[model samples]
Target: MTTTISPSRKTNEAVRPAKQPLRDRLVRLQRRIPIVQLALLVLVCAYGLATLPGFGSWMSIKSILILGALVGMAALGQSIVVLIGGIDLGVAGYIVAGALMVTQFATLNNVPFGVAFLLATAGAAVLGGTVGYLCHRFRIHSIIVTFAMGSVALGLAQLQVAGAYGGGAPVWLTQMTSPVMGTLGLPIPPLVLVWAVVIVLAALFLHRTAAGRRLLATGANPRAAELVHIRTRRVWVLAFAFSAVASVVAGVFLAGFAGNVDVTMGNPYLFESLAAVIIGGTVFGGPGDYSRTVVGVLLLTVLTTVLVGQGLTGADKQILYGLIILAAMAVYGRERRLRDQV
Candidate 1:
């Protein structure tokens, strides 16, 4: 006579062991994702220094910081949208608006830069708020609303300039973004310093403010947030408004960086911003932070610089970006929505 296990016992044993493996796998994956990204950044940097001429040169390094700052600034806004379970496709349009604003209002018309900047940011807030309101009120996905809003913004911007969007930034502004110009003689671009300051402020706003907590709560679970009287719709409105304003700021500085402004000046940043946010391990509906975005920005900049040094064509770069995004998705896509965790 042999002892026999009950069906219930067998089921428990089998199911428990199965779950442990899955749980272990998930834990390992969570640990590996960030480490892998950082490791890749290091590896890419090493490869660049070894194989790419001028990759580690002072000018090249400065170029990387400036380029990364632009992308990081744009991605900063995208991070807010993603945190709130939304995406802002209108970033490019708002960037154009800002660039055009500086060109038309400040440079061409000779309005003061400070006044022009305020007007541009205020207008962006209104447009972005409207986009958020429509999405919330109508229960529409942000992708559709923002895409339409972006097109409208672009058209309006073009119409405003009457197809004559051409101007140079003020000389002082240009110097501010120049690679040779240092912050307080510290050998760092002023634009880079500004980016660093913005990053610090953003991190503080997200982690230290009540409003920031509310935004995170809304993204984690809108219905739950509403049940708790969090006013998620308002959060949405403010989030998108901030997104627009951030894009505008980036655009203005970017105009200075390039010394000129155009309606299409912000086109490339559209996808790059979203790509950086995604690559930064920030999932939709919360569960991410600005620090991750910083790492992602650095990685992307270094990788892109290396690729460019290798003489990759535009088409090839696009293809590579697509593949990199897909890889990031594979790693982070499986995360449970923050709502579930909540």
Candidate 2:
């Protein structure tokens, strides 16, 4: 004899919560993806701070945050362009140009901070728009146009500087670059607060708004986006414009943080920003998956600090950075393949 259960009882049992299988839980955690980046971040921080005697100081933390903030800003912009299936090689140029223009306006022309900022912003906008136009109008690869623009920007910056440029940031900007608060022997840089605020705003922009969703969708599948009557060109233009804004912001803060900017200052940011985005689990030319890319930026900053403590040369750091980028790219490629197969 067999007992039969009532349908209602079966339904109730089905709806009841149950413990997830370990394998299933692991799969779910893996799917979250960013958790991997978070884990890596923790691992790196722990290793660096534990091994390096002077790496865990408040000064060290603040230094990392300030540098990370600059890189994070660039990564944020690069992520935007990459989300739309494009790369902005011109970011370095925009950054350098913005930094130079800001200082030149304030120091050379003696303009107010507000006016100088607007002018720099306008310059970046025009540059961004030009890059977008080339991509849209000529059907050129974003890389080609942006790369050329980067060269042009460097030249422009050099011309503007005219060989000698020297100035200090305003008192307000200086204060922001310095520490804003401290508690329990830990000093907090205002730049960190600014970075956090920007991250929150970016998270909201990318997740909460229809426009942001549209941008991501466009990047993920331009053909499908166009089929759905989404203005894909406009999205691309918007992405570049936003990127320019980000680079400019980074430049302004970099000027304040470093007390000035040189022609070569923005060079490293080009690769560092891309690495941060990828390591943070955001794939290039895929759906914009920014699981707090700032974490990746901070990890790199910590790594840099650790390397410096170990007296590693720039070449050593570059090699390590390149290896990490390649590894991340492989992971991204594999994830994409698995997604496609599924």
Candidate 3:
């Protein structure tokens, strides 16, 4: 033990660097991703302000926020489902259905708006829950299940409307989304405030609640979750149901924002919601939250505005979105799954 090392051996030992602990590396990676994303957000905003006309103006900024809010709302259910290792392809269908049913119920059935709203959301929840239960019971992939269900939903919605698509939103609904609209006289759109409240509530629910923990456990490893008595199937059903509800609400708000309802209006959100979740660094299981999604929503909104300012066509924008999503998945996909980490 007392033998002296050779000079070369001593030099080699001195040059060798210490390996970082695995936990430390993991924590660093978690921190680094968000920081990099935030930096990118800031850079994009600064560039927009510098180059895009009126990009720094309140009107321009408000428009971005409002658009981001709509996307964020639609992405809410996608976020929940994806957290549990599933995807919801039916969001667009639910959005359109909710929009159509709400208007039709109020106008044709002569029901109160509140009753119509309830009926529309309730119908969406039923459809979504059925999809969730079917996928879990049959051990099928959610993508297939949700896609077929979405088609069914769209078909039913079309029948309900009898092919007619245009209708004005209620005045209060429009006011809620108006830039000049305020909650409690705050001078900001009530819709934006509602979005903010949703963000807070969602963060709290996912991070601080027992049900949230169960949901995460189920997603991380269903087998392990079951061993501990967590009902994975119930989690799936509830998650998709919630997703349907969120998408429908977003549809309702979108109708107001657009001042009318159209069957195809919700189509863009199907892709955009998924894009926002992935771009926000939320993996398919565990460790992602609504806050990351909010960041993603903002990043996407700003980027789209800049692209519009640069006069990119709709097709060009779609191409860019695809590329950006690919790049994001490439980076985030390499991370170890939650079960693997365990």
Candidate 4:
């Protein structure tokens, strides 16, 4: 002050702009993220289509959509559990059990189609609820419990199959889900429509309902939520129940699609569900949304379809898919940490 500041220094100080609000910056960053990811996905799909002959064919597109729809349903359930800071390792088990139940009731046991389907779903839900209770009451880790439960479920399915091969789907279920509706020669399966509806409903529930807020809070910080009088355990139980219900619905579609039930039908979906959730930008133990999961499913489906269409073997496709999922997790992890730091 005694020496008087230089005019250049004063001008420099005066010209500095105020920093942007942290929330505003975060919002802007988030807005850009989805667009970037979507653009990348689209580009990858386009590259595959351009380079691979027949990749853009109607059959190819329909196959991709159908596979994505099935995996996406299970992935949605997994996402719910992951959002609640839990994992359901019993996805394959529940799906197998549900399908077996449906098949047995409708075919072997000669029950009504509608009744068989409802009972199958209910059975799966009960199984899920029991697992949830065990985890909550006995302080068992969900992963271990669900994994063990999956084994049990598989064993039960095998028992039901009893080394027999030819019990097909009920006529009604097959007729209702077949014919593959679409627009302008594009094949759109009913299962795809079902998945779209489920995802949309789930998104609305999570974003616009109090129960969803509680569920999210429980996942974000169980202790804090407990202190605020939120029944964290109940939320967890419901999450597990929902996961089971979703798996059963997926099983119904699988049964309809395959036109038969096998003991091993649901085994592949376990990993696929996990992959879809992670790829969908739902970080473990963090905020998750259904819309992102849908994108994740589509990306995965497209990638797999393109690879298969290019004559890549199943094993190679799986390896590449794992790599992609790892890359996605890395990116999402960095972004999450950066947000926390800011």
Against the unseen true structure, what C-alpha lDDT does each candidate score?
A: 0.85, 0.78, 0.87, 0.77
Worst 10 residues of 4 by lDDT: 333-342
Return the TM-score for each candidate structure: 0.90, 0.87, 0.92, 0.85
**214-325 per-residue lDDT for model 1 (tens digits):** 9888988999999999998899999899999999888888888887777677988998888888887887886787778888899888988888889998788789889999
Using TM-score as the measure, the top candidate is 3
Q: Write out the backbone clash pairs for model 4.
A: none
Query: lDDT tens string, model 4, 78-132?
Result: 8988888778999998887777767764566677767877876776677778877
Of the candidates numbered 2 and 3, which has the greater TM-score value?
Answer: 3
Model 2: clashing residue pairs? none
Per-residue accuracy of model 2 over 88-193 as CA lDDT, tens digit each: 8888888877777778657877788888788777777777877887797688999998888777766776676674567666766766777554434546777787
Clash count list over all predictions: 0, 0, 0, 0
lDDT of 3 by residue, 1-342 (tens): 598889999999999999999977866776445765677799999999999988998877778889999999999999999999999999999898878776754676677878878877888888899988998999999999898887777788778768667656789998988887778967678889899999999988988999999998988889899999999999999999999999989988998898878778888999999999988888887668888888989998999899899899989989988998999888777767888876
Candidate that scores best on lDDT = 3
Which parts of model 1 are misplaced by more than 4 Å? 1-33
- In model 3, the clashing pairs are none
